[model samples]
Target: MLGRTAATPVNGHSANNNPNQLALPVNLPPGQQSEASIVHQHIQEISNKRISTLDYLRKAHEGRVYWFNTLLFDKSDLARMPYFDSRRLARRATNHLFLGLSLPSVIDVGSCTPLEFLRSLNILLSEYDAFQQLHAEHGSASSSLSRARLPQMFRRSAPGSKVRRTSNAAEVGYPHDGGDGGGANGTHNNSETTAGSTLGGGGGGGGGNGAAAGSAAATASAISLAASETELLPGEEYTHLLTPSIPFEPDYFETFATLCDVLIDTYQRLLTLVPTPRECAGNGVAELFTKADGKLRKIIIQGTVKEFEDASRQGVKTEVANVAKVVLGGLIST
Candidate 1:
């Protein structure tokens, strides 16, 4: 009985050097009870411990420091996460890394672990690269398709010559009498004879017929010139006309509208993520979390939207640049 305490032993015996000695009854608080009375208590404790371990595992899996430390120090499973589809989390990590590095006021990213941040950053970068590749490939394909179809878009000349016709009365102003000089009243005309003599004594009627023929030839030449010059240049006016007045080619409009829609939708979605100027400044831990969250959202949204817009803009510029190449090629081939 020297060192024995009034507690139950596993074998229901006290440490009194006697196998048959029973343990003494212990003093109990109001809620305290024997081990058997607290049913499943050990199991509950083990379950809680398991939950805590799982939580730690999840945090490590999602953390930026986990990735960085693994890469820089441990060389573990940093490469296992599928970065392409996990871009949202990756983007969040990137924001944290930059904020930690660049922001003077952000002395420490409290509670936000480094491994989680790095993993998110890696995912975001992967997504951005994928998007860039897609945009480039799409733009190249679109340009080639447009170039292939450009020849069919050449506007043919209008059905007839665009020249204005002169009046028949203007062409036949003088009478068509024989070479002998005569006036409209059937009288001998000295003035008309003098005019005719200037043309080697040709009759006035011959001069009139010659003048009419020359006018007709001039009209024909003018019509030919007009017809040759009537094709429209590629410009706003031409675009407007082509949009609705001409045949609606699905390819042209579909590509253009898709680009515009991507730009506008991205912008709209980004606007939702940006914080107001007031929310950017605060002190409390809760307020700081809110601010950080808002800022992170804005950064991710803006980055994504800007990337899309830039891609679309570059695609359009490339398309335009290819127009000259296609035109030159057409000219050479023709």
Candidate 2:
């Protein structure tokens, strides 16, 4: 007991104030960080810095005009117009650029597996179908719909914007490449030929069979015929998905459409890349995350931009459009 050092007092309480409580070290040694931990910390710091910089930039230039091509043409009478105003044009261009860049965060295409992608795509596709139906039914001039149908979150326009602006349906440029029609799958093309040959061969043998055997053969033939008409090859199964009417706000209609556009475009591109079963089996999932560049990337980016243009014309929801833009860009990049 004499060898033990006296407990030092800290503020009003001494270390010995609570005899039952085990005292903690005043100067605890720092934890030894693993290589991975150090790397993680470094990455976290970098990410935080990047986020801070972006936030600062956003706040700094919130309503400023950026002269992308001002020297090429002088400010005209049209510049005074609401749509043609310099600040509005600049904001649109900036939003469009940011939208493309934010796609990675929007969808995280790189991390998702093929099955996950397909499932996500199925949801978006259904939503898009429902939106189209809603538009057809209620988005007409004669339809007395206004902000009443919109959700409370989206009914009111942002400050400084007009309450009810005229919207024109703009033409969307979908990738219409004639060669991209799953002809390369080979299975789809030969299905009819193969079924026809099987039917012909089965019918030839049915004539020689006894009454009971003939009945069985006829039943089998009927089943095969039905299957031949309805069956889809692997990977082509998405075509059979029944798009149900999912109630969504008009605010999200454009977003759904854009997502479907990207998903379909990406799937089509993947189909072209993987023509045979063996090749598809190996490269199908791997290629989904491949960084798309060169001409393929360019085409996808252009399509995304076109979606934005169409959305803008159709009274797009600003927040949702931004999210869609990011998702499409991410998909193309991934």
Q: Give candidate 1 misplaced runs (Cα > 4 Å).
A: 1-297
What's the count of clashing pairs in each model shown?
Answer: 13, 1
Name the runs in model 2 displaced over 4 angstroms.
1-33, 63-98, 101-169, 172-334
Model 1, 164-205: lDDT tens digits are 221122224334455333323233222233344444544444
List model 2 lDDT by residue over 63-117, tens digit each.
2222221211123422433444433343233222222333333245531333344
